[model samples]
Target: MKFFNEESDFFGLTKLKERFYSSDHDGLSEADREYINRIKGQNPFGIISMFIGGVSFAFGPIYVAFPIITIIFCFLTCGTFDREKEDNPWTFIIGFCLALIGLFMYLRGVVHELIV
Candidate 1:
């Protein structure tokens, strides 16, 4: 199994092969490969988050409609962290923190509007 660096624009299989065999490469074992495959098979929370966010933005003020969309976005963002923790702990932490921040901001904005 070969891992392609998606960051690069060049999509040649030769380049991918070279990267796979490069000295800087630290290859994964079969177990690691299986784990990655499992992660890929699992639900992607980022997709859910963006979908909810888009709905919320399109439908107008959250205060006017049911808060279900906002709630779903929060849940999905948190789920993203949970899903990422096994393989990428740092990403899990960062994503979780950012999600929390977004939730807080939304709540604060709602409260501020009500108070004013």
Candidate 2:
């Protein structure tokens, strides 16, 4: 199924696929493009997600909020990085995995607490 019509771009949330989103990259070299995208800075959500994921993995037994927040930040990181330069949001991906592990640990701690 179809959730949204073809005429709409999910309320402009989805972008139409193209070679390049901006005309600035049309005549530039690969190095230039990379430089510009880098100057734009990394995705904040991704950075935060990674940091929080680490914290959750370390202290998940203390609180449930950490993993939940990390998961949210990981998903929110989509489309924040430049794809044209072959940039991968590995930080967010790793964060997502770490958060899942943290969540598992959290559940284990909860079970252990209950058993004791």
* Candidate No. with top lDDT: 2
lDDT agreement with native, every candidate: 0.41, 0.63
Please identify model 2 stretches exceeding 4 Å from their true place: 1-41, 110-116
Steric clash pairs (candidate 2): none
Q: How accurate is candidate 1 locally (lDDT)?
A: 0.41
lDDT of 1 by residue, 26-114 (tens): 59887876665465332234444444444444332434232344553444334333333234334323333444444554566643354
lDDT: worst 10-residue window of model 1: 1-10
For model 1, what is the error of residue 110's alpha carbon versus the real structure, in angstroms, after optimal superposition? 14
Tens-digit per-residue lDDT, 42-104, candidate 2: 445467678888887766656778888878656654554555444468877888888888789
